[model samples]
Target: MPKQTNVRCPNCGIQFAAPVETVIDVSQNPNGKMLLLAGSLNAFQCPNCGSPVRVTTPFLFHDGSKELLMVYVPPELNLPKPEREKAIGDLMRELTAILPQGSFKSYMFQPREALTLQGMVDTILQADGVTPEMMQQQRDRLSVLESLLGAPEETRPSIIEQNDAKIDTQFMQTLSLLIQRMAAEGQTEVAQQLAIVQEDVLAFSSFGQTLMRDAQEQEAVMQEVAESIQALGAQPVRADFLSLAQRYAGDDQRLEALVGLIRPAFDYAFFQDLTAAIGKAPADEREKLETLRDRLLELTQAVDAQTQAVIADAAKLLQVFASAPDEQALDGLIRENVAVLDEAFLSVLLANLQQAESQGKSDLVAKLTDIYERVLGVLREQMPPVLRFVNELLGAPTPEEQQKMLDENAKAFGESLLTTIDAVSEAMSARGEDSIIERLAELRAAAEQALA
Candidate 1:
């Protein structure tokens, strides 16, 4: 026996076998008000077009899980009786040349002249000016002709011809072929859709790469401008970085790169003013330089807040790290990265504690412990594993070794924060934060090492 065909497009009249998945909605109650699926059939699709298909498996009379296999008909594809009749009429017209006048006489159940009358009716119905109202009147007349055609033996000699039957069957076959052509057309559509998607992605990637390059160029410009302004003994204002920053403000990736590039300038600005003060000068000259330095310090105080404002978006800021040259834009990047990590670390710690308290589970503290361990693990992975272990151990039993790591990590965030404050302070001849100033070297070293 031949394999059975399982699926067909009612629209196109194409048929083929297919493995398909089907959701079986099962009703738990006999009232048919509530439904639950006994089980779903899986892995079913059209072999030709890959279109998803479903088969409604009927529930067995006895066993609930044992369903009866049944043929599926898509409800929307069913043609109404009137439409089917019209389709048959249209097919008959296609076979008009092959049907003899004697054949039509038998079909119409009247004199041979009736065949010509039916042809005139069909011609008027097919005309462009014939409206639905006119077609309805014509169909009423067609009903009479249909009745005559049904009585083939009575209508044989005068109203119908033998050739009519053969022509009609051939026309029905042509209609079936038309439906099959439609099904074949559906198979090629998915490829056209995929091509459109590929084109869109290529365009987006090209745009992204262009924007990234523009950001790098702007970052270089910002660095140059910052250095120039600091060298002139002037403060770089918001306007100084605006042109390049504005170019990328709307772009998340480019804006991040801009921030990383400017950070070093801020650090260098601090160093320049502090070192400038050691020059020998008369009392008034020294005082004037000190005053100018103080103003520069005030300007530096706004840098962090301003930088944060420029890179306010979290999605945009993440892109900066990727764009940073060799992962070291400046010493300050390390401090900034650490501060971000510290803030995130603290938030996670607090959340874990809250959850532990709510659940009354002391073991929940393991999450916090894991995070702390990861911080150390990241250091080990970044550096050497032995060095990481050494640093961890140094923080405990060996006080001397412990202080070194403390001082090192402390310098960038702890000391660097102080240096930034002092640079601004001394540039204006203002009071310095003494502890930070003394530890500046260690802080700078830590920042440099972290970034390196």
Candidate 2:
């Protein structure tokens, strides 16, 4: 977990709070690795100036899947050789305390240190087969993005004109991807800023403007596809959907139209169409057709995964709440996920309660509500700082009062709350309290080993 530390902005000379985590044990919660890759792991937006600043702290990156362990200390810190060795020793000790007995490999004892965070990330990406050329392209996009954001409104056009080639379809897609991630993580302000940038890109850049036009056509095609699919009788199966796909032109235009529109719905039926299209194509063009099919298949899987991950968390929490044999089990689950009392979980509980009520079950509805509140009370007791902080912020008399409180206690409330948020976000991918319990057990077992 990141700690709250003071940061004095070079430009503004005002100090603000930021999160700095030194040890990231990705074995327990791999989602932390994702946040790290997205560049949001330890990023803080200065409330005073809205400028993004990073905490200049060393971090350990661990990925058990690859049997890899590494550390990064900023060269700017310039710790003495003895002190650097001591710090690395301390960090590794902590890492050892969070893994199961004998789970760590022999190579982990000899630590690898990076002089920069980028070097650490690049190392990981290279292992994943992301080419240096791809990494350079990403860096180039970021450079142009920085320039555009820094330029004045009047000068922005010139910056855009100079980097017009860089601001192509790929850039727009990258921006859209980031925006979705921000929204999912509840970073509303950042998502809004990205949206504005997206709008400006779509309006100002020639390629962006053309892509926007194509997107409109895509949406139209999607609407028509939806209408066509719905017009089929109830319980339409794979055959029915494929029959609809056959109505489109057999050439590349049809494939493009199909992909442009109903991309997410490319299930077995769509694959059937793709198979037929591939079979009909000339041998030379068959590879291109197969490539298109492969792309859509990958896209469909991703779309389905994102949806399931978002909603499955809520559903899983509900199941745990309803199935707890007694208060102890409920307490354990709530402590594990922290969303034991969230509304989505409650909605599921309420639906079950209503089902019981409809069947004339006695006191089940009241029983469910009581159990929920009781478990929530336990969470408040266990993590009062977070619970109290969130309560007061929400219970503020007015928006202005809320803002004032946040500004005054930024350090007390902000970094601490963010730690909990990071935990919760990681938990979204968890199976339920069971997975969380197993994870915590692993940590506890490792801690005990350190004590031994």
Q: List per-prediction Cα lDDT, in the order shown.
A: 0.38, 0.64
Per-model root-mean-square deviation over C-alphas: 30.2, 16.2
Which 10 successive residues of model 2 have the least lDDT summed?
A: 443-452
Query: Across residues 1-452, which tens digit of lDDT does each residue of candidate 2 receive?
Result: 44456677655678765445678887664545766777656555445554555566667888877777888877898989998888888889888888899787977978787767788889889877898999999889878776765666677777777878888767877787677555433355766666777777777888888988888786666556656665776576666655565465344444455544455456676687779878988898788667766765655676567556756766655664566555434443343344234555656666777797888877777667766676556445434466565455545777567656656664555455555544543443232244645543443333233333
Q: How displaced is residue 213 in candidate 2, in Å? A: 2.5
Per-model clash counts, in order, read: 22, 0
Residue 159 displacement (Å), model 2: 3.4
What digit string (tens of lDDT, one per residue) describes model 1 on residues 1-452?
A: 01122567444445555323221212221211111111112212343444534443311111123221111222344657686445444433423333345443333221111123234233323442556775665454334334433443434333323323322322333323322222222322433333332233223334324445676687565555444445444455544543344334345444444444454544564445444543655665666555544544444555566655544433233333323333113111221233243333444445555776788776545544444454444334333233343335334555465456655654344444435534533433222244534444443444445435
